[model samples]
Target: MPQINEKTWIIIAVVIALIGSLIYNIISAKKLKKKRQQFTRSIQSSYTHMKTIEDTNKKIYEISNEINELIREQKDTKGYIEKKKKEIEQIRQMIVTNDTILDCTISDKRDLATEKQIAFTYNIPTGLPEIQMEDVDKIRLFANLLDNAIEAAESVPAQDINGKNKRYIHISILNRGSNFFVTIENSKRTEISVTENQFHTTKLDAENHGRGVRIIRQIVAKYDGTVEFTDKGDTFEVAVML
Candidate 1:
């Protein structure tokens, strides 16, 4: 309990005030640091949520594309089924016929490619031996042949080839020794595909179509005949011997 000077008391008061201010500033700095950490955590959480949403959206997009592809496939299948029904009917009729070429005049090779601007020629002979199979088979054969010829000839626009336009078909039927020979010659094929003993047409008509050569082979084999397909650079020929 000593008596203190006023100046010393003032000095003590100033020191206490400075210490209090320092404590207050340190506490405030700790509080600010904690707040900043919380803000950083909040931002990270928001980013993670956005990433999840983005992944979900991507999955949904892929699912939508798959669904669209499935729908297109179903539509194509329906069209194919409808087309196959008509083709089946025609094949059935061709299978259950008993008519012969001698039973009637099979007139199918006249101006067959007229609409396609393709020149057609023929030397079909009369009084030939009747075909071993149904005459309907023969009709189908000729129709398919002429159609393929027109398709091939029309693919290459009528152009000058060495001096002449080569968009024409020449078909002949005659007797060779003891066998009936059917020969078909048409414009040269710039593009042709042959596999084994089968042939394909130029049209991209579905899978069920373009089987003309297969049908022709079936008919020829059924009648104990031999068929030949030759590609001669500028001309194509098919010969059937029965």
Candidate 2:
């Protein structure tokens, strides 16, 4: 106790250094494990946030599509209203005059066979040549064409069982060389039957309906026009040349 040997002191110092090293290693290992756990938590949090953002973006995209569809529907409604108004005004003018009047307003409701709306589009060429035809005749022809187109389109199924797109109708009129050409196209579920004999309709109920095509043919014939009917796949096309 009075005088410690140098070798013993040295051995004691080595033992102390070994103990300190072990303690330091243990502390460092604990700290390293804690850091690893923190890093893992941070990574999981980031992944969660990313997934949340992705879901949010998908919802936003769906909402945007819905908004766009709403806007399109509104526009179509507006257009239909305006067209009806114009037709009503024309009918009123005809009543005021002493000319023979024809009720040319076609119904816009959905047909019984199909749940889709009866859509119609009309086109009148600009810069029409001066002709001898009366305004009433023009209106009658256009009205009949549109009516027939609507009927044809309504005959087809709007949405299939798989929820596909609805049927539609398209009408175009072009005046060339003192003649007017009208084309009407409609989406069809099955192939349309075209005949040169008596006119036939695919409409199931024969009591109240099924005469639209015959009436259109008569109207076209009254104007000394030629009417041609054709079928292509699931589409029916009617052309009138006057």
Candidate 3:
């Protein structure tokens, strides 16, 4: 081989340097593209994780609201149960004594009268005969009658508007060998409406107001008893014999 010239050697060296530089640039570009792809994957994974956390938080909030509602309902149910328990205790006492009317007067009627500012009086003998009836029937009979009398007494305006002669209610029960006589009298307002011997309610709620008399009549009829309604102008009286 002939000796290479100086210029040709210089040209060959420059071309070798150019080829190495080109190869290095290609390798660097490939590494940068791989890094970009990894960054994109990381961003996508973070977005998916954030969405999952939001969904879980939303479910937790809904569950908390439902738990609060259930707690409120439970409290209401407990209060209702307590009220019924007191009523049951009162009924038990009435049954044990076999004196439903007297018990009603002592318990509910007396308290109601006191609260409504009405004068309540009752004449029950010490040795009154035991009522010969079922506990339920006895309770229904006296409770309905007394309730109606008390309601009517509340409607009567104070005498002379000076509240001098306040409204009054009186109850009397007497034993007559085989049967009993029961009477309830109460102060009333004048201008009572009577349709076919039945008194109409003067209350604003006409639908629910007039059912008490019917119920009382039905209870009396069950024991072959008699009930009379007498509206004495300013005073009303209901008499029942059983």
lDDT of each: 0.62, 0.57, 0.71
lDDT score, residue 201, model 2?
Answer: 55
Model 3, residue pairs in steric clash? none
List ranges where model 2 is wrong by over 4 Å: 1-123, 126-132, 161-164, 205-211
lDDT of 1 by residue, 7-121 (tens): 9999999999999999999999999897677556545644554554466567557656755876877755566457556744533222111223322222233344656667766
Model 1: residues with Cα > 4 Å off, grouped in runs: 1-107, 126-129, 161-164, 176-178, 195-203, 206-209
Q: Positional deviation of 72 in candidate 3, in angstroms?
A: 60
Q: Cα deviation in Å at residue 71, candidate 3?
A: 60
* Residue 62 lDDT, candidate 1, scale 0-100: 69
TM-score of each: 0.49, 0.44, 0.56
C-alpha RMSD of each candidate structure in angstroms: 34.1, 32.8, 36.0
- Steric collisions counted per model: 1, 0, 0
Q: Model 2 residue 127 lDDT?
A: 45
Best by lDDT: 3
Q: Among all windows of ten consecutive residues in candidate 1, which has the lowest summed lDDT?
A: 95-104
